[model samples]
Target chain A: MKNKKPELVTTAATLEEVERVFEAGADAVTLGHERYALRQPGHFELEQIKEAQQIARKHGGRVYAVMNALMHHDEVGELAGYLEQLAPHVDAVVFGDPSVLMTARQVAPELPLHWNTETTSTNYRTVNFWAGKGASRAILARELSLEAVLEVKRNTRIEIQVQVHGMTCIFHSKRELVSNYVRHQGKDPEQEIRAAQRRMFLKEDNREDQRYPIFEDRHGTHIMSAEDICMLEHLSSFITGGIDALKIEGILKPLEYIQTVVSIYRKAIDRLAENPHADIDSGWLDELKSIQDPARPLGTGFYFKQQIY
Target chain B: MLTQTVQSTIASPTKRKKPELLAPAGNLEKLKFAVLYGADAVYIGGQKFGLRSKAGNFTYEDMKEGVAFAHAHGAKVFVAANIIAHNEDFEGMEEYFRTLYDIGIDAVIIADPAIVEVCKQAAPHLEIHLSTQASTTNWQAVSFWANEGISRVVLAREVSMEEIRQIKKYTDVEIEAFIHGAMCISYSGRCVLSNHMTNRDANRGGCAQSCRWKYDLFEEAEEEDTETPQIGKTELPMFSEEDDSFTMSSKDLCMIEHIPEMIEAGVDSLKIEGRMKTVHYVATVVNTYRKVIDAYCEDPEGFVFKPEWMDEILKAANRPVTTAFYYGSPTEQDQIFGVPPKMAKYDFAGLVLDYDEKTGIATIEQRNHFAVGSEVEFFGPKRDNFIQKVEELWDEEGNSLTEANRAMQKVKMRVTQPVKPYDIMRKEKK
Candidate 1:
């Protein structure tokens, strides 16, 4: 039997980044227009998404539009309309909300759907549920270990996507905690509640030195992992585990970071394609270490040891 | 606004069947109290494969009795088989579902599609209600479940009144919403913080409630030490001041005032959410909602929300109340940040174990401190509450006592009125 290597999935915030990522050899690039996604500092407009789609297609890459925000009832009507507009421009719409997934299935029946239940799809049964409901791909939760991922792969035949790089979100909430904090301090929330701009971190009193970045946007607050996930070393394991796609999580990251990270994964995947049975090159690890953000630490995340609370 | 206008124009309670009042029961005793206190349906967790593992969940034998008790009272009993089952968790689930069905459980509240499939194979006759843990927010999601033969969807807490109206308009699936309960900081109940922090899976039955823990702020050090290039840089303290505030603990939701809005929106059921709560909590909250719902149904046009209902609700609340995301997204005011110690004015006094009509005395299992002269109100199934002074008290040993303080202590107290088993006694607010 021929060994099938997983595709490299990367995220981009703009058409420029999309071009850079495609140049770096990403098979598919995930992007979404502003106000329609959970990402902060999201700048892509409908025109930008269309442009990015055109660039990806030109480079023989695919564009997956993110519709992963937790929707309120009022947004449903607008969302159906937005999905209808964005459908033709993208290959598949990635979603965390069931409502959004079902809405996409209704509004754009031809468009494929990627189910990312935002860490809630902890087991294979949830993936199977979405698969039965018409999800073409299922993004495994960040909390899943490699063993769990293997278990899921063995059970379900649906294409599986795993976050192999960048920040892992630990906490997500609808309440704007940072805005509430500013208001509690007697400051105007409008002026002082620019949490995404500030790039603030939160630490528990007990675990004083550890801090996780708190990202706030129109959708809600997202507290990301203290350390960025680097699974460059585990590329072979994921491929062997039958993962369909290895996703790089940071879309709004610096273009240099995106290019470097995507290129590293691209090289890794290419090397694996050449020699499927060969061990991951130590030089790749060294190269990843050289470009590691001094401010942000790197860890293997829950892929090695599952986070339990 | 349209719902408000329509509700206001209804000169009398609409002839439509009033939505069922659903209550949570942690144990068999609480289940009886929930049905007795005017709950049309009661949801409980079994010994396994359910959320609220800390709750004194029913054994199979207890469930059999509880189900019979509920059915006898014309109320439905739902077994919460709502855990997000992994492959290992499904080992004994099929047998569990068969047992639940054989015992005549009205429905199985489930979240995982695999478990729903298991139930279908094991107990095809049983109805299925999707748990809020499934996070059904939109009509399409509800439609998806409805197509799968799910009779009801406990809408996610993130859903709003406007959305409920829209969902009802679009889908035939019955909507059951949390009308009163502790709120989760995460969307729906799909949180992993508890599991990540404490190793207790929140999706499975164990939740350590890590969100309620206090957190301090810290910033990552921007500059690296050039002299010690190999050494890791330490994170810097973001704030010099110390503050003890719970940034994640949300206020308990209270929707007593919004009963009209819910009814007008065509919600199918109003669910009260504390399964691990005491029987007194169940009785007080269930009774208060029962009165409010009845009042609204009696005269929709003449239905004026009484301020006294809020006062009645406070007697059962442990935390400050917020309307949650019902009106809109909750503001800073909606959350309780600082840990303000709260005490309900009325304390759960005791539960009547038995009453001797000849002696005019009741055998009570004391829950809180109560003295001989303390004025207590006794309430029970289909009976109006009556106040009486505890003139005499006797321990199980027949020794006279002036007061009862120890929890679960059996004490005989003189009563002026007849009290039945399961009747709850409470000390009045001074």
Candidate 2:
């Protein structure tokens, strides 16, 4: 019997990059309209999503629309209309808020639901609970250890997705912190605020080594990890352990970064699926190193070290 | 005489169903004080499976006594077992649920669905209130939880007043929202800054509160830029010396003025969020909010926001207050920016252990230093607050003393007015 390998999921930076990532080797590309999505790589209107869907169909790839914003009343009121328009264009919807689940069930019953409640999707019972509610997959939190991830996969009936490579969100605030800080400094926010600019980072007074990248957008401020998580070496354990999809977060990266990461992870997943006992490939690490930002270090990220404060 | 008048006025129930005043109780003592002070319900952390691992959590024995005390006073006790559980944390969880149910806990505030499953299967009769850690900000999510058999849903602090009203309109499930407490800059349970910075897992229990730590901003160098600015190497410091160092700290939430708005929004419970606070804090906050809630409920049309309530609460408030996310998105003003705690105008002097009305002498257990000449105010749940000067003082041994400086020392002080046991005595700060 042939082994079942987890699908390669990449966040498409643009509608044009959707086909590029699918060509590079992604089974699915996740993107969405910025109004409904939080910290996405790029925004896509319904027409653009339809275009991406056509492109996905040609390459036999799937498209997942991220509608994972913690919905307020206004967003909740407008979600049904957006989902109704978006229903036909995407294969599934990735959501963190349960409001999206209820809305999707009513408006687009056929589309699959991928539960991705950033930090709280820690245990199997919660994942299974969402699975019982018709979620096809659970996106495990980046904070989970490898052992915990396997345990969740072992117990759950639905597909489990884990981030394989890219910047992990360490903090998300609904407040416009940078703009507010600029205003507090008696400067014009339009000129001083680094809205979505990846160049700015925060260094704790006590910790001089680490510089945490920060950005502000319509959803609010998001602090990215100083280290991007590279799970290429651990791809065997996840794919062999029965994780359904591996998500590569392309939120702050360029199209080339996404391409390199997807291809490397894809090759590694294939190699491991073909031979479970294969030796670690130094060449794959070398390819990923080509695009690795020296300033933004890469680590295994909670896979080995317990995240303590 | 004042107690009788206050009691008689509230004896007649309000026409509208007023929201329950819920308070946090870190231990059995805080629980009793919370119940006595006017909290309709008190949420407590047990010895296991709770997020505040450092808090003095209640033992099963403590739970029984606390539950009994609350229930005896017509108040409810809810256990907060709201940790986002890992696989190992599930060990003994079923037994824990059964034990909580056996203890007659009113409900359990839980965030993890898996733990909720274990709880339901083990103790089906145990009521569940979804924790704000789940971040349920919309009506459909509330309804979804309702469909799942949750009795109540504590709306996320990020939720707005208008969103709350809309949620209540759609679902019959009880809505609980925070009216007072420290605000997390990140959405509750969504941050891993502590985890990434330190080895502690914030969701399970240990939160280093790395957000409250001071951080200096640095600009990243462009690609191919060899001269990347190193920490302390740049001539121009990112922030001026006078700028707030605690960049991410939010002003604490105090909704004393918004009692009517909360009640009108159809909130079933107004939660005060400080489980790790002192008994004095629990009493002061609960007492003030209880009076305000009762006043508004008794006469919604004639209800007026009282400045006195704000003044009373400031004695317990550690930080400046803001109506976070309720009025609108909190701006720069809502951030604390390294300011010190607001200086209190008063200090908790003592608790009235026994009051002799005929002799007008009160036996007190001292909390802070107070002298015989100190001007003190006596207040309690039943009676209106009254000020009097301490004319004379004696030790527990009946020896005359000029001052009560020892912590928890029993002192006898002559008072100007009749006092009751459990009455709080506060001295004005000089």
Q: Taking the tens digit of each residue's C-alpha lDDT, what string does model 2 give over B186-222?
A: 8889898899888789998889999988887655544
RMSD of 2: 3.4
Question: Could you tell me every candidate's TM-score relative to the true structure?
Answer: 0.91, 0.95
Residue-level error in angstroms, candidate 2, position B229? 16
Task: State chain A's TM-score for model 1.
Answer: 0.93
Global local distance difference test of model 1: 0.80
Q: How would you encode candidate 1's per-residue C-alpha lDDT over B186-233 as one tens digit per residue?
A: 775556776566657787777877777877555344345654332354
True contacts kept of 2: 0.81
What's the TM-score of chain A alone for every prediction?
0.93, 0.96
Show pairs that collide, candidate 1: A308-B195, A308-B199, A309-B195, A309-B196, A309-B197, A309-B198, A309-B199, A309-B200, B13-B300
Instruction: Please give, for residues A213-246, the per-residue lDDT of candidate 1 as tens digits.
Output: 7757777777777677898877887777778999
Best candidate (score: DockQ)? 2
- In candidate 2, chain A reaches a TM of 0.96
